[model samples]
Target: MMHPRLLATSIAVVIWGCGSAEAQTLVLGGRAGLTSATQWLNQPYFGYQRVHGTTAGVAATLELGPYFAVQAEGLYVEKGARYYTSYQMRMSYLEGPLLARLSWPIASSRYRLFALGGMAPSVELRCAGYQTVNNPVVNFFDAPPGTSPLDCDSQRQRHTDRSQVMGGGLAFDRGPSQVTLEFRRTRGSDIAGYDC
Candidate 1:
């Protein structure tokens, strides 16, 4: 007869050993890319244009199998929008994304095509606004009665944002390194102000 506690412990150890043999591989990487961002403002009356910026980050990928993986990234991103000719706003953020990726190789080649979908949560670090004064005298004083000056007054922007990310790109895989190009769209809740 065997002790129940000893039998249970042995069984647990065997299961743990088996699970360890099939553990996912963790790969660490870094990425740098350009981004075009625009604020989805509630006020549609204000025409917003895309603002170009840069994104750089470190990423960790957990390879679950030949076709499936999960990736997480920590990045610094700049986002904002330009309204009309004189007013523009830029905001900086620290962003993190958790993404699920599906990949397939091309006929046993070193190149792979992958698609990723994810959610990114970001914290705003700073926000700034700029305006080009075409005519100082005209802007300083409303010389002509209905014409308004350049509204460069800063507003209190929200400190946090969350966005849904989706995109696909190609990757070239080397021994321990890979080069990838991806285009992703990020849409989300309003960053500031109430809906109009």
Candidate 2:
């Protein structure tokens, strides 16, 4: 697999090239967002838990034309499973998306739309994947009489694979500023993690 720093660099360079000529025309901004996933993705978990959580991050977008742009974001998420012995995991990631956007004004009502697909390489910093075991580093939500602790070995590793990113949103523009509501999903591996 590629190094995390290298992956991020490649994304930046490629995006820069895609809109280099119109770099000045790009709209520079930041994003505040969150993420959630199903429990199936958290297999081999320490225990039976909800496995749903929120991830927050920021992104910057580069627009080459009215219909073409590139965006990059970095995020951190905390998640856990609620079983006999609950376990928690923390993930950090950086993502890049090649976006196709459209914008036009209808009288005084302005609108903007964009769709994106890209790669996201992530790093697993802290994870308590073995809470079911007798000696767990983290606490639990609910456990059976003797579950011998949940399988938490997977949480003690790091993966940086190219993850999949896809999503879009609508925005209202007024002059140089706009307000947008967007949603996206970063599909990671079921066992390989969000990166690998």
Candidate 3:
């Protein structure tokens, strides 16, 4: 597997090249936003709540034409769930998303309505916070109870994840650059280690 850093650099280089000619435009920017993240647990044990966190990233977009574009981003995301207000789990990740986007001008104005959907591959950087232990049935490891402590272990969790990304938003043209307000959701596709 390619290293995450190398993969990010590769994406940037490709985006730069794609934007250099043929009436293409390159838009580079930073992103800072709020995230309400949660995990889906298959077991009927714990009730999960959305955990609030911050998301920040850098994005490179290559506009192929007036209506279509390709975007690549490198982000640090905090994702996890809160368990009954007593415990909050936070898992940090390095994520790379490559998306295909479509945009349309709103009545020939500077405002545009856009929608984007794509796949994002991510690596878990760390896991923190608390794990609630009630009856203590099967732990995250799926081992016999008591064999594994109820603690945050990054290694025990899956290191890599494949996710689906879907979002839509409005964009305002600003000369050579654009300002956008977007709403996006990313969902994990594979079961985490032993649990979903």
Candidate 4:
């Protein structure tokens, strides 16, 4: 659950932006994209690899001027990493990003270039892992006496994560509609047991 103060602050920002008369334009749109996510682990024994996922969301932008805007989004994002040879972990979250955007038009206002920097707060919806081991083990300390190494799956409950996001993109304007191509990087918070 989100803290009440955080929720109130978010609401205040939105209300202030919309209430300002200097906000000359409002753009509302939806976006979908692919994400390559991986964990940054400090453990020497664990080598994490990127895992591909999907992200989709709706965005709202309040233009403060010709070159400045405040944008916010509500998105569903999938993030995780792979370790060892056949072990994988996955986490899904509902994320919200608040960004400051700067844009300028070029080539007779048909093309626009923009850059954005933001912070995203995400709440975990699900977490799971997949592990596969071929060698059978019977060590009581780590497993039951007769326990055998086999494919296994498990789920975990985790807390919310806050990430730093920054990116740049290009947009093409056609009358009232615009198309954008953006590239962004999201650096997630470190887990308690994970070093760095």
- lDDT values of the candidates? 0.74, 0.53, 0.78, 0.75
Stretches > 4 Å off in candidate 3: 1-21, 132-150, 154-156
List, residue by residue over 41-71, the lDDT tens digit for candidate 1.
5666775788999999899987665566778
Off by over 4 Å in 4: 1-23, 134-157
Query: Candidate 1 or 2, higher TM-score?
Result: 1
Q: Candidates 2 and 4: which is better by lDDT?
A: 4
Model 2: how far is 48 from its true place, Å?
A: 7.3
lDDT of 2 by residue, 1-196 (tens): 6799978975665564454473435445556655554334333543234456566666566566454556666666554444434344434444444444444334455676655566666655554443335553433444444333444454423344345777777766657766677887666654434322
Superpose all Cα atoms of candidate 4 onto the true structure and report the RMSD in Å to 1 decimal.
7.1
- When superposed on Cα atoms, how far off is each prediction in RMSD? 10.1, 7.2, 8.3, 7.1
TM-scores of the candidates are 0.74, 0.59, 0.76, 0.75
TM-score of 2: 0.59
The TM-score measured for candidate 4 stands at 0.75
Which of candidates 1 and 4 is the stronger one according to TM-score? 4
Q: Between which residue pairs do clashes occur in model 4?
A: none
Ranking by lDDT: 3, 4, 1, 2
